[model samples]
Each structure stands twice: as C-alpha cells, then as structure tokens.
Target: MKLVVLGAAESGVGAAILAQKEGYEVFVSDMGSIKPRYKAMLDAHHIAWEEGHHTEANILSADEVVKSPGIPETAPMVAKLIAQGTPILSEIEFAGRYTDARMICITGSNGKTTTTSLIYHIMRKAGIDAGLAGNIGHSLALQVAEAPHSTYVIELSSFQLDNMYKFRANVAVLLNITPDHLDRYDFKMQNYVDAKMRILQNQTADDTFVYWKEDEHVPNELPKYSDPSAKCGFTDEAQPGSAGYAANGTFVVNAPVHFEMPLSQLSLPGRHNLRNSLAAAIACLAAGVSPEVVRQGLSDFPGVEHRLEKAGTVNGIHFVNDSKATNVDACYCALESMTTPVVLILGGKDKGNDYAEIMPFVKQKCRALVYMGADNSKLHANFDATGLPTADTHSMRECMEHAVALAQPGDTVLLSPCCASFDLFKNMEDRGEQFKAWVKQYGEAK
Candidate 1:
C-alpha cells in the first residue's frame, strides 16, 4: 500500500515511521522546511522524504494520506487530492485502526492539556498502563511504536477531529467551548463550535461523553449532537445529572459503579481547572478506575506546565507562566484563576481577538498590563477605557522587567499572553521558558 504523510513535524514523522514499520510504502512531503531533528529521523530510517514542496504527482498517487492536524482541508493541494478521489485521514484515526488501547480523549477550547495530562498522571499513579499522546507529550503514533498500552489519554484539538472518522473514544471529554481558532473556521463562531462537536461524532451508547454541564455554550446546543446512551455530565456550579457532579464538594459519578472525591481536595486550583478536573475524573470513572484511585489521583495531580505553572517567587511577588493562553477566552480562564492582583503580561500575533469579551475580568483583576508581541495596538485599543497601567514591550525579557518594576509584594506577574507567541517567541513553549528564565534571574537579583 502506498501511503503519503503531510507536514513532517511530530505527528507527520511518527506516522511515516509507523507506516514504514508496517511494510507500507511510505513517502513524506512538507510544504515548509522540515525540522532538522525530523529530517535526521527520516534519514536514519532510510524513509523517503521531501521538504519545501509537495510533489503533486507523487502525493496524489498514494492509496491513503495521513494529514498532520495543523494543515487545513482547504489547502489547494488538499483540495486537489480530494478532487482526485484520494483519501486523507488524521494521524490519530490512521493510528487508531492498529491499536486496541482503551482511549480516553479530552477536547475543548481550553483545559484539554491539563485534563489529558491529569488523567495520564492518575492512570500511571494507579499503576495502570497508560500512554500520553496527542496535543501533549510524544506523538501517539510514536508511543504506539514503542509500546502499546492498555489505555491512552489523548489531548485532542479541533484540527485533529477534522479528518477523523470511525475513531471512537472509550471516554470523551468536552470541557467548555468559546470562540477560538476562528480564522480556520472563516471567522464564524458556529463553524468553530461545530468543529468541537465533531469529537462526539463516532461515540456510541456503550461509550461515555463526559463534559462540563455548566459551560454556557455546550449545554444549549448539545442536544443537537446528543446520544442518550453515551450522555454523562459534570458541573462545578450544579448537579447536571444522576452522576458526575460536584455535590458536597466532591465530583461523584454513578455509572460503572460510584466514584467520588472532594472538590477542595483537588491539587489544581481555580473555577476553570475545577471544570477540567471534573471532566477528567468522570473519564477515569467510565474507564473502570476505582473510587479510591480517582480520589487519590485528583488530590495528587500537580497540573500541566505552561497553563498557570509556577515560576517561583521574587521577593513576595509570584511569577506565573501561562503562555498557553493564546486567545481572549483562555485569558479569561487565567485571570479567573488568580487569587492576587496581577501585573498581567499579554500580547502577540492577534487572531482577530474580541478584547471586549475579557474586559470585565481585566477591570477586576489586572493591576497593570504589559504587552509582549508584534502587535499591541488592538490590545491597547480594547483596554482604552479599563484605566489599568499599560505598556507595550517587544520581547519577553522587556515584558518581564517592566512587569516586575510595576509589581510589589503580593502582586503576581503573570505571563498569560492571550495571543499566539510567534510574534515574540518561537512558540508558546519558548515564550514560557523565556518567562521562567527571566523570573529566575529576577528572583536572584532580589
């Protein structure tokens, strides 16, 4: 079988390696320059690959194509491939056909990484054989290549769901939906929402859809995609169903036997993360995790890095790295989680952000604002009436120094850029690491 892989990043490379191992004739093509590390991998394995071009003739001849989630289905080459009647599938869907692992999948506009990581953490804590993959750690395909596990906690994105068909999660989690990645959906809210709903497309009655019952967007339109047999819900503010709710400070799920744990006992803080916590707990329960394991896991899980991770204290002022907050809605989540007044550092490549959405939170928690990115005008324009001290800094170091100079004891300096990090750093991880390093230096100076 001739199989072609697109976008030679983590997912694409892993898919190519897996296909080669399975005796399928594999070729990898990337429209952009492939990373040196991935290029090395392809070379070491003698895998045929091309970069900076998508040889049209070669790609369209394949029996199937495994697409990296980052590539849209609307690319001209992709359209041409479709026009030629060639099949394109996500790396996840392609990989799933070969694995028998019970899948635990997490999705939402936010909190997916935290919840997915937590479930993987708990599964390992409980001595369950679980592998972490998808939008988080290593590629799921690579993990499958190394050692297939009894369970997999996958952090899924709307992009990954776009090409997936016939892939079913043993447990599916929907955290909360808000306007995110709208550019990909042609700037339409419903189109993006519809993309998120795709996670439930193949779920069955025997399967489970664990979600936040109180998320404003999910509940109102969920019935459109409802599957009565798979319905399971969780809410921090109310009991949404017969099970998986916060009643008496615990998330309790009734199905597949009862499970419960105190809400205060969860290690991850904030109303938003609590929602993530609730969804992860329910997924664990549906997968047959005992109440004792759930309870222990919830209280012990430390939380994922780059989503409100602690960077250490300089004097009495704390620095937090939330560089993963790439949109206004995610910024709202980060701000909502803060206990102290924040000298908030935010900015980057704007994705047509509606700063009005976060105005209320900004008016309340932000003591001062430091912007880091290529474009700060839109942020400044939206914040005109908020009356918080604001400054535009072009890099992470300047943003940190300016933010620290404005902060005093008890004030938190948060690096929760509500925009993509490409303007100032290579990506969110690079942005986050720079923030952490500066904070360490800032701490030592005091």
Candidate 2:
C-alpha cells in the first residue's frame, strides 16, 4: 500500500515512520517549510519527504493519507483527496489501529490540556503504564511505533476529531464546548459542536463517556452522538446522576468507587479549574485509578504553562501569561478568575469571535484594555464603547509598556488575548514566551 502523510511536523513525521514500519511505501509532504528537528527525524528513518511545496502527482496516488490536524480540510490538496474519495485519517486514528492500549481521550474549547495532564499524572501515580500523546505531548503514531504503553492519555482538538473515523476511546472526556474555531467550521456553531462530539464515536457498551453536564452545548448534543449502552458520567454539583461533583468545598467522585478530596487542596485555582479537576477526577476513576492516587495527583500537579501562569511581579504589579486563552470563552474564564483589578491585554487574529460573550467579565474585572495585534479594528469596534481606558499596540514590548502604565500597585496585567496569535507571533507559545520575556526585562529595569 502507498501512504502519503501531509504536513511533516510532529504528527506527520510520526505517521510516515509508522507507515514505513507497517510495510507501506510512505511519502511525506508539507506546503510550509518543515522544521529542522522533523527533517532530521524523516532523514533518520530513510523516509521520502518534500517541504515548501506539495507534489500533487505523488500525493494523489496514495492508497491512504494521514493529515496533520493543523491543515484545514479547506486546503486545496485536502479538497482534492476528498473529491477523489481517498481515505484520510488523523495520526491518532492511524496510530490506534496499531495498538490495543486503553485510550483516555479528552477534548473541549478550554481546560483540555490541564485535564489531560491531570489524568495522566493520576494514572502514573497509580502505577499504570501510560504514554501521553495527541495534542499535548509526543504524537500517538511515534509513541505507538517506538515505545508502546499499556494505556494512552490523549488531548484531542476538534480538527483531529474531524479526520478520525474508526478510533475508539475506552475512557472519553468532553470537558465543555464553546464557540471556538468557528472560522474553521464555516462560522456555524453546530458544525463546530459536531466536530467535538466525534470523541464519543465508535464506543461499545463497556466504554465510558465523561462530560460536563452543565455545558450549554453538551447536554443538547449528547443524545445525537453518545451510544445508548455506553456508560455516561457527568461533572456537576452532587446530584442523582452525577459521576463527579463538588459540594461543600469538597470534590467527590461516586462512580467506580466513592471518593472525596478537599477542593482547597487542588493545585490549580479558579471556578473553571474546579470543573477541570472534576472532569479529570471522573476520567481517572473511570480508568480504575485508586482514590488515594487521584487525590495525591490532583493536589501535587503543577499547573499548565501559558494558561493563567504567573510571569512575575514587577513594582508590586502582577503579570499573568494566558496565551493559551486564544478564544473569547477562554478569555472569559481567565477574566472570571481575576480577583485583582486587571489591565487585560486582548487582540490577535480574530476568528469570527463575538466579543460580546466576554463584555460582562471585562466590565466587572478589568480596569483598562490593551489591544495588541496586526489589526485591532475589530477589538476597538467592540470595546471602544465600553468607556474604559484603552491602548492599541502592535508588538509585545509596546503592549507591556501600555499595560504597565495602565496598571497600578496591586493590579494585575493579564495577557489573555481572546484571539489567535498568528498575526504577531509564531503561535501561542511564542506569544507567551515573549510576554514573559518582556515582564522579566521590565521587572529588572524597575
């Protein structure tokens, strides 16, 4: 069989190697320049790969294709594959066929990384042989091809779910769905919601589904995708059907076994994090992790970087890097968690975001606003009428200066841009690192 892997990054390279190991004639292609590290991996594997261009003849001849989640279906090459009815699969799907590991999969608009990490930590603490994969760590294909484990914890994105067909999760977790990446879904909420619901597909009666019972979109869409016989668990306040819940400042899990832990002992803060913890606890419990292991893991786990991460304090002012809050709902959660008055830095590539979703939190918590992006016109259009002091900036350095000026002692300067970072940085990580760098530089000068 001839297999062509699209986009020679982590997932693509991993897919190529896996296909080669599986005895398929494999080729890798990326329209963008492949990173040096990925290029080295492909070379070491003796795999054929092309970068900065896609050879249409070679790609169109594939018996199957594994596409990187980052490449949209709207890409010309992907469209051609669809038109020709070629089988297209995500690396996760391709990797799944090679391993029988117990899969613990997580997806949502926010809190997925933290929840996925928390579950993995608990599983490890309980001495389960586990590998972390999907969107958070090493690609699943690479791990399956090189170092397979007894179980795998995966953090999936909507894009990856779109291409997955036969993959099944033994323990599936859908944290909460919100309006994120709507641009990729053609600005339709249902299309994005449908993509998220794919996590529950191909489940059996023995499989488990964990979800946020209170999410606006989850409840409405649950019946459409969830298997009737699959065991369903929900995160909510302790109730008749709740699998995990928080009540009286205590986190509780009832299914698989009864368990409880003090909410105050959880390492991550904020109401949103409380939900994340609940979801993670449910997933761990469903995976048969013991209560003692879950409790210790929840308390000892350090928070995810670039998601409400403390940069540093400068001249009595606090700086928070929330570069992962790349959508309006994520910024809303960050704002909802702020106790101190905030100078909220927001702006980037707008993804058809309705800023109105966060206006209430902005009015309640923010003292000022800083717009940082190649274009801030949409931000201004939405926020200029808020009657708050605002500054427009095109660079991180300028953004920090304005935020510092706007903030006072005891104030917090938060970088929770409610839009994608592509306009000004390589990605969310670059945006966050730059924010931390500027904060450190300013602190030293102070």
C-alpha TM-scores of all predictions: 0.94, 0.98
Query: For candidate 1, lDDT tens digit of each residue in 236-354?
Result: 65553644556767666665567666677889888787777777777887887777888888898977789999999878999999989998888988888888999998889887778
- Model 2 CA RMSD to the hidden true structure, in angstroms: 1.1
Candidate 2 lDDT over 276-308, as tens digits, reads 888888788888888888899999999899999
Residue runs of model 1 more than 4 Å from their true location after superposition: 226-228, 240-242, 248-251
Query: Model 1's lDDT to the true fold?
Result: 0.84
After aligning candidate 1 to the native by TM-score, how far in Å is the CA of 167 from where it should be?
0.8
396 in model 2: Cα distance from truth in Å?
A: 0.8
Give the C-alpha miss distance for residue 410 in model 2, angstroms: 0.8
For candidate 2, give the lDDT of residue 172.
91
TM-score quality measure for candidate 2: 0.98
RMSD (Å) of each candidate, 1 decimal: 1.9, 1.1
Q: For candidate 1, give the lDDT of residue 187.
A: 86
